[model samples]
Target: MTTQPSPSDPAAVALELERIRRTIEVGFTRTDGALALLVQRHDQTDEALKGHDRRIDDHDARLDTLERGETERQKRDIARLDALERARWPLPSVAALVAVTGLTLSLWQLAAR
Candidate 1:
């Protein structure tokens, strides 16, 4: 930009305008190149993030499967424990036998009296 020019210097003003135009063209080229690099980097980042998301989803599914398997195993273990407990105590049969023995003792004591 020519700030001031003699009235008789149209050619100089034109030349200054041309120089400014060329400078602006160069700046635009640099800006375009920088923008293109940024776009390329952004695309690469997006692809990487998408891959990570897929991996995370797969991991989550695997975890869910493992949890389900663990739950089933726990249920089977609880069933086994319950069977063991029943075998150990057999509460109903034991209670009935105890009551009958106590009755027999009481009857014997009455008879003796």
Candidate 2:
């Protein structure tokens, strides 16, 4: 429906070239806009990833603190258990003394009777 410029006409050729230049300019503009948007999105994603890294680091620190506390608690519990084991070591000696006392008392009572 449109008339195109003849290649032989200087003015028409100039006009056609101008039109092509404009079209190329528009394409470049659109590409620039898209590239700008991509760069912005990449920056935002970078910030988000940095934030996640900070959170992960914080979680790791907290877990390490909890582990250290638990390790200290386990050590204390082990020491207490060991001390209790040592305390029970004299039980057999006390039991033997009670048995000997009971036997001596029974023998003395029989002699008196």
Candidate 3:
């Protein structure tokens, strides 16, 4: 027949078990702190991405406005050019006018002389 352990040995075993429980609690606390830090970093990253998206949308709106302005300017330039072409006047034919004026001037000079 075997003898049972004494009460003093059981007390020692209880102390050892308490120490192990404390160690596990400290490790879990450290892990909780690290997880909290990671969550904070993720939140900051999300905010930064939102800011970037807003800036991109602003740029897109500005680009659309610029395109509309360019189209309007081109239309005005084309209309002005067309008006200028339509308003142009043709000059008289040079050779026939010169010959007629020369003959009239020579006859007038002979009559004067």
Candidate 4:
């Protein structure tokens, strides 16, 4: 619904061209600012990721130490069980000896009477 500029109007065409150039310059300036901000955010994210990696590495070291301690505890427990197993037969041998001694005493008393 708007009237077109007359082909003969050089001044109007030149003014329109100047306005478009200014608009494009503004858009380029804004785009540059946005890109700069993006770069800063990316750098910040990289630093945070590095910090996380360090924490993970520290956790791994702690876990390794914990695992070694648990292994030593388990080995000690197994050794104790083995020693207990080896000592199991002496109790029955001592009981047999007591019973035999009592029987011998009874027999001797009967003979003496």
Model 3 local distance difference test score? 0.87
Candidate 1 Cα lDDT to native:
0.91
Q: What digit string (tens of lDDT, one per residue) describes model 1 on residues 44-92?
A: 9999999999999999998987777666777888799989987797788
Give the per-residue lDDT digits (tens) of candidate 4, residues 1-113.
Answer: 99888868998899889999999999999999999999999999999999999999999998987777666777888799999998787888889999999999999999999
Give lDDT per model, in order: 0.91, 0.92, 0.87, 0.92
Consecutive 10-residue window with the lowest summed lDDT within model 3: 87-96
Clashes of each: 0, 0, 0, 0
| Model 1 weakest 10-residue run by lDDT | 1-10
For model 3, how does the per-residue alpha-carbon lDDT over 33-108 read when each residue is reduced to its tens digit? 9999999999999999999999999999989877776667778887999999888754355667888899999999
lDDT of 3 at 18: 92
Between candidates 2 and 3, name the one with more favorable lDDT: 2
Cα lDDT tens digits for candidate 2, 1-113: 98876779999988888999999999999999999999999999999999999999999998997777666777898799999998776878989999999999999999999
Native-referenced Cα lDDT, model 2:
0.92
- Model 4 scores what on Cα lDDT? 0.92
What are the TM-scores, per candidate, against the unseen true structure? Answer: 0.58, 0.63, 0.55, 0.57
Clash-forming residue pairs, model 1: none
**Superposed model 2: Cα runs more than 4 Å off:** 1-4, 70-113
